[model samples]
Target chain A: SQQGEEDPQALSIQEGENATMNCSYKTSINNLQWYRQNSGRGLVHLILIRSNEREKHSGRLRVTLDTSKKSSSLLITASRAADTASYFCATRGIKAAGNKLTFGGGTRVLVKP
Target chain B: TAGITQAPTSQILAAGRSMTLRCTQDMRHNAMYWYRQDLGLGLRLIHYSNTAGTTGKGEVPDGYSVSRANTDDFPLTLASAVPSQTSVYFCASSDEAGGNYGYTFGSGTRLTVV
Candidate 1:
């Protein structure tokens, strides 16, 4: 089984509407990172939130993490057509010797323009 | 561009032939990693090198092998290609071991074995 799993496997929303996706992990982590993959392109780094941090924002992307719940959420405000991509959450284990990351199945999001 | 170049954007190989996917990054990063992306399985780590001259096995390292001889290049080789090895391969690198900053990924190579 994967260490991290995402909810709402797929999402579809209007261009101006907000889009939100959740990720849950099963173990302790040092940090959590979110990535976006546009169709055939490689995964692009979005945001990284440390275990001690609660929330962080970049441009229109907002990310929140809850250590107690072992989960995280990514929210895009006023989404645009370019936001149509698959979102994946990766976790860096706290006890891992190296900086290896465990990735989730990902959430496929589609923005209707 | 973050200075990562992946050669042979796509390739088709015979089942028993051997092939090597080339990956080069100009970021001078110490940690490099290889991962395979599938339909529903997301991405699985194949192999990683924390620094030049050292390599380690990842979550899925059975059929794939990788080597980081220097800081600039890391290549993944398939000893005996098989149909099951077909997948989109990605090469990623981080400034630090944990990507405290972020991970830079290549455009990716689409591989098919038949």
Candidate 2:
């Protein structure tokens, strides 16, 4: 089983609505990162929240990490149709190096324009 | 700049045949990885190399072999391809270890096996 598991395997919302996705992991991790993938391309890194950081924001994306609960949330405000993509949460084990990442099942988001 | 280039954007291979997926990066990264993506499974690492001349198995390494003879290239080979091996393959590279510095992924190679 993968270390990270994302909830709400699929989500549908309006273009202007906010979309929130959650990710939970089983082991201690050095950091958690989120990536986005289109229909037929490679994943693009979205955000990275370190274990020591509680919250971070970039552009319209806000990410929060709670080490105590081994969970994290990504919030996309004012979502757009272009944001329609699969979101995956990946974790780097506390003891692991070499840029290795373990990915979750992913959350597929559909934004109706 | 071509951060990473993957050959043969797509290919069809018959079962019991051989195939090799090529991955090259221009970033001079110390780490490279190969992952397979399937529906509902996200992406699973097949193999990885920390540096030249080293390789390690990942989550689903079965039926897949990889070699990192140099820093610029990492090739994944299937001795005898199987139907289950059909998936979108992605190659990624990073300057250091762990997720502190995220990875830059290639466009991906879609392979099908009959």
Candidate 3:
């Protein structure tokens, strides 16, 4: 089942701009993860933030998780054409739950060069 | 190591034909999973295995079957292909069951049933 739901199904941004997307989940989680998928390709892990943490960063990507709200957001700074792809948010449930990762619909970002 | 490899990158099959999508992970990860991606449905889990010789059903396991005979392989089979099953399938693996680590995904298999 889909544990998370991403808002703004699609977004358009120009090169050197920033793109941000939000994801909200319905249940308690162990962590939240972000993935990127190019057209016709598999998803690649971008970042992961544990439930106890509020924010983390990797290169140009920043992820913030709010356990209280069961929501998370991914921000890409100074985006480029190469960043044009579908970004997905996934949640890993508590240990008692299966090790499965539930994914959201994903936000398709178009970076115009 | 090849994190994960899915066979028949893409396929077109008849509605009643049976097909098996293969997945192999050379990373020797202890956890593996299968997911299907539709246009707007995102990715739905079909099956998962925490370790060799153990398997579990995921959200959309109705017409799908999975087997993890060893640490490196997990295959998904469709008893009878249907138009509704026409979607891109992805195989992923993580270091452990709790998913404290990030997952590595295979390129994916695009299956089309008519």
> How large a fraction of the reference contact set does each model reproduce?
0.57, 0.79, 0.74
What would the per-residue lDDT of candidate 2 be over residues B14-114, giving only the tens digit for each residue? 99999999999999998999999988787899999988898999989999999999999999999999999989999999887544888889999999999
Question: Across residues A2-105, which tens digit of lDDT does each residue of candidate 1 receive?
Answer: 77899889999999999999999999999999999999999999999999999999999999999999999999999999999999999988986578888899
Clashes of each: 0, 3, 0
Model 2 stretches with alpha carbons more than 4 Å out? none
lDDT (tens digit, per residue) of candidate 1 on B10-62 = 99999999999999999999998999999999899999998899999999999
Q: What is the TM-score of chain B alone in each candidate?
A: 0.96, 0.97, 0.97
lDDT by residue (A1-109, candidate 2, tens digit) is: 6888999899999999999999999999999999999989889999999999999999999999999999999999999999999999999988775779999999999
Model 3 residue B37 distance off true place after TM-score fit, in angstroms: 0.3
Better of 1 and 2 by DockQ: 2
RMSD for each of the candidates: 1.0, 1.1, 1.1
Q: List the candidates' TM-scores in order.
A: 0.98, 0.97, 0.97
Q: What is candidate 1's CA lDDT for residue B108? A: 96
Candidate 3, superposed: residue stretches over 4 Å from native:
none
Q: Give the alpha carbon lDDT tens digit for every residue of B38-95 in model 3.
A: 9889999989999899999888999999999999999999999989999999999998
TM-score for candidate 2 (chain B): 0.97
